[model samples]
Target: MLDLHNHTTRCKHATGTMSEYVDTALSQGVSVYGFACHAPMDYDTGFRMSFDELQDYFHDIETLQERYSGRCTIRKGLEVDYLPKHLDSRVLDADVDYLIGSVHFLDDWGFDNPQFISEYMRQDMSQCWQRYLHAIRDMAKSGLFQIVGHFDLLKIFNNPPDDSVHEAITQTLESIKSAGMALEINSAGLRKPIGEIYPSKQILRKAFALGIPITFGSDAHAVQQVGFGRESAQRLAKEVGYTKMLDFHNRSPIVCRIP
Candidate 1:
């Protein structure tokens, strides 16, 4: 099994040592486990690792990679927020196995943050969804990432998108396909208010139709959360007719069977 998204204490919001996370993945029979902690940005200093800490994070992962060299595959990555203006070149240009591009804000609004969720009540849901997908499109077009994190994170607060959101989703998926990026079926959403996996089944079916490959991420922020919803994620992938998932090694794709 492979799970490419996880966090470490440096991320400021996650708990546990990096070794604990890797050990947990090992206990869960995960053959390939990656750490894609939130990459630092000038805008969200409190929730992510700082630019100065980037090297330490890299060194920590490198240590784990060597420590568990023969037992398990430990890959390095960064979950970078797709903030065009605040994007840090250091984080973007860092040498990692893969970068998972994600969008957690719409302009100045951190739409998915629970502290700022009340803002959703004051705006049009359709427009909010549209803007979020457009941001995803732009992120995919940037050509800096290999994976898309939490494809439908905008629904974190349970605001399901209507049919009108389809066009934007299609456009975003097209951009992702054109960029040769894979969509991550993130399991973190199941632990959120939405009570489902990211990218909903409909979106997964659509992505399959477009010949888009996929990857799996637990988005684990804690020890127990490592490989938390992997079974469900795997089942969902099979249900959507996905027979293979992408793994990364030094930023290159390696296709593996879903089973």
Candidate 2:
């Protein structure tokens, strides 16, 4: 199994060094080891790291990659929040092997009213969905990431949107396919209420119809979380006509057969 999305201590939300994660991957008998910590930016957000430490993040991972070069294939990668308004082009043009594009916020999703956040947290499942799919369309057009992370993350905190949302979801997926982008089947959502991958079965089926390649990621934030639900995620990919999981080398996808 392969894991493409994960975080380390470099990002405020996670803990541990590159080596610790690598050690866990080796022990688990993984064929590939990826270090996709959240990308450091010059922003002042609470979730992202400072760009000043970007070099440190790269340096530390570079050392671990060399140390484990013969034992395991270690790679340097990042999970970037791709808001075209806030993303600095220089950050994307860094030395990392590849990056995951995601939009955690649109102009910060900065709701001022406690009620907006609470209401967002409490919307009649359908209303909250209207807001999320709108956000997703904007994210897809932003053109900042090659792999879209958590195609339906709003479901993580709210209720699932219905068939009405499928039209917009399909349009976005088609655009992603036309642009030669891969959509990720994130296993991380299994811990949530739906207990299924983001985008669900219907969306996955639509993605296959649109001719998009599917990728799988644990979206792991800790060592033990690495490769979580990966076997099932692979099976889900196959159910939707994808026979291989996505691997990136020099920013281009290199498909690896799933067993």
Q: Which candidate is the best by TM-score?
A: 1
Q: What are the runs in model 1 whose C-alpha is more than 4 Å off?
A: none
lDDT of 1 by residue, 1-259 (tens): 9999999999888899999999999998998999999998998788999889999999999999899999999999999999999987898889999999999999899988899988987999999998999999999989999999999999998988899999888888899999999999999999999999998999999999999999999999999899888999999999989999999988899999987
Full-model lDDT for every candidate: 0.93, 0.72
TM-score against native, each model:
0.98, 0.88
**Model 1: number of clashes?**
0
User: Candidate 2's residue-wise lDDT over 1-259, tens digit each?
Assistant: 6667778776777776667777877777776777777776655356666778788877887888788887887666888866656677657888776777775653556332133366464346565566656666665666656688888776665456677777777777877876677788888888766687876888889888878887767777777787778777878878878876677877888888876
How many residue pairs clash in all the candidates, one count each? 0, 0
- Could you tell me how far off, in angstroms, the CA of residue 164 lies in candidate 2 after the best superposition? 1.7
Error of 2 at 208 (Å): 1.5
Model 1 TM-score relative to the real fold: 0.98
Report the C-alpha displacement of residue 146, candidate 2, in angstroms: 1.6
